[model samples]
Target: MPNAAPEIRTFLCRSDNIGVLIRDPGTGACAAIDVPEAAPVLATLEAEGWRLTDILVTHRHADHIEGIPEVVERTGARVTAPEKARAAVPGAARYIGEGDRVTVGGLEATVWETPGHCADHITYHFGEARIVFSGDTLFTLGCGRVMEAEPATLWRSLVRFLDLPGETAVYSGHDYVLSNARFALAAEPENAALQARAAEAERLAQEGRFLIPSTIGTEKATNPFLRAGEPALARAVDLPEGTDPAQVFTALRAWKNRF
Candidate 1:
């Protein structure tokens, strides 16, 4: 039997990104994932009637951490982000790097410096919950562009993230489920789970719902990027079978950037 009250709860914010708000209902304290803007975060805090105790920023992107200053000013919550992001982020009270851990009430989140989407990107792992705030680093069926790092470097980064426990819930930043699915389908139509997930994503999009915070096991079952080393991915992208996973991985992301 599972403990119903302690399950980490998350929901959509503005229908674009899945900003998770985890609070100990037992204590009424809260923590927010990446805050794209201050208003919606504040609204969520208001609705829960919980005090904003902390903010976790995964990267320094404007869309990810743009609302930091305003929120910090109002709530005075402690802020934690990657060490490299300290220069870019405003109002961060504590800087974190790989292996460091932070706690919000009873829940704990470990920091992993996963830099590829940007030179300073990081992922926050809610250890006990088996959840990670992946930012733009890892998506449901896609990963972020290798803008700040080379394809090889980005490939290594993605591979490292994939090594996490399979059941870990991945809460990414953007809502790319449907578009990623279309591209994944084009890249690997034979993937039955991807096809089914595409249908589900299409339905969710049409219903004005969000499709994010998917599990790593599910991504392994459907996400082409997560399956970069598979022969099916090789065929989908026209790469020679048994090519270096890094190369195949590079090509897959490049194709999606265009798609």
Candidate 2:
């Protein structure tokens, strides 16, 4: 039998950063994806009556890891950080890389080193549950800016996600759906599906609700960055049909930088 699906809660952290809590119903073991801020994380844990057992670090960016020390001091949670970011994340009890498995109670996640926004970035994929915690590397309808690696490197990391089942639920680090929707429309103006999605984004923003956990199928259809191989997206970037997908992806990312 498969493990029981974990209960997930998403709330705002500092500014636009998203804080996520995953609790395994079977053993009551809980984990936080990243500690963007301690107050909100601690409050949420207290309210939910879940004791945090693990802190999964995706990268070493100050905003992402700044609250780790405080949270650890409070909860005594064990931390799992990227091997490359060991020095940056001082409280890490275990440094992991690609192919490593992390468990909380009966829930398990496979660590994937998806470096593009930063060299230490990694994604936690719960394959059996079809859920992924994509920290900064992949967002809702948008990918991260090419900050550390070349655009091609980021493109490669994004491509790896395409291999997952379309129903996979994608939980990203930030809530940038509104901005990403505007750019997606500009990139693929003729896409009816994208037009509908943009309208939905507008409605959600009006109600002060966020668009999170977008499905891989929804992203594949509406995310311009993921559709760089499509002829329409290539044309939007002033590239001819059949251009190398990576080159098209590079052009699309460049356009997004300006958008």
Candidate 3:
């Protein structure tokens, strides 16, 4: 675990999307993870008085990468993106893959290729910082829709996150926690933790506050998608006890897609 947390600033962009500014305080190196837009990000940089040194691209989605050009033009930050989705981020200085590490201000981020939302989706794990930029692969009380891979494949990708340290803080690409909480409650209303989380998510939504940076431990306890293998969730979903977790996850994802 990290002795001190890095300086992180979160704001909304493109209405429902998330924008993140990561800073290494010691050396003053900062990164923008998936530029949803450039103006707000630049304003935040100016307010914080931190120079942007890196632009970490998680996937090729338009909302995620659209602001890259302007951001790079203004800050000259080095761009890193997935090898397969390089086209979306033209002129990206680096193409990264699983196990590749990118260093900024001496802080290292190990890349994990979590390709379910998109065939080339990737996540960044800053283990020492106990922070994971999960991209679209994982979210608070939810997981990404299996847009470019099989349900089982997506389940495997989610499992990768489940293996992270319990205290690992997760920052996702979007702010979808309100609807996710509703779906989780519908799927497992009997869960006390889920009920409590739903209420809290409602409160946050009503206040227009951001609902992210949730921890791995909290997701395990409150997220039905993460609890597919558990007997309680299996029963709640009307699947027989001991059913394959992948099947339950597939059913849950299908249900959510329609919900």
Number of the candidate with higher lDDT, 2 or 3: 2
Candidate 3 has an lDDT of: 0.90
Q: What TM-score does model 1 achieve against the real structure?
A: 0.93
The sequence of per-residue lDDT tens digits that candidate 3 reaches over residues 1-259 is: 4435688999998888899989887788999999999988999999988899999999999999999899999999999999989777779999999999987785789999998889999999999998999989899999999998899998998998888899999999999999999899888888898888888888988898967889999999998889999987788768999999999999999999999
Model 1 misplaced stretches (Cα beyond 4 Å): 1-15
TM-score head-to-head 1 vs 3, winner: 3
Write candidate 2's Cα lDDT for 12-124 as tens digits: 99999999999999999999999999999999999999999999999999988899999999999999999999999986789999999999889889999998899999999
- On lDDT, who's better, 1 or 2? 2
Specify the poorest-scoring 10-residue window by lDDT in model 1.
Answer: 1-10
Instruction: Tell me the lDDT of candidate 2.
Output: 0.93
lDDT sort, best first: 2, 3, 1
Which lDDT values do the candidates have, in the order given?
Answer: 0.81, 0.93, 0.90
User: What does the lDDT read for residue 156 in candidate 3?
Assistant: 90
lDDT of 1 by residue, 1-259 (tens): 3212433445565557677777756556678887888888887777777788889888888887877778788898889888898788855788889899988777777888888889898888876778788888888888888889887777776777677788888888888787888899999988888888899988988897767778888898888887989998987789899998888988888888888
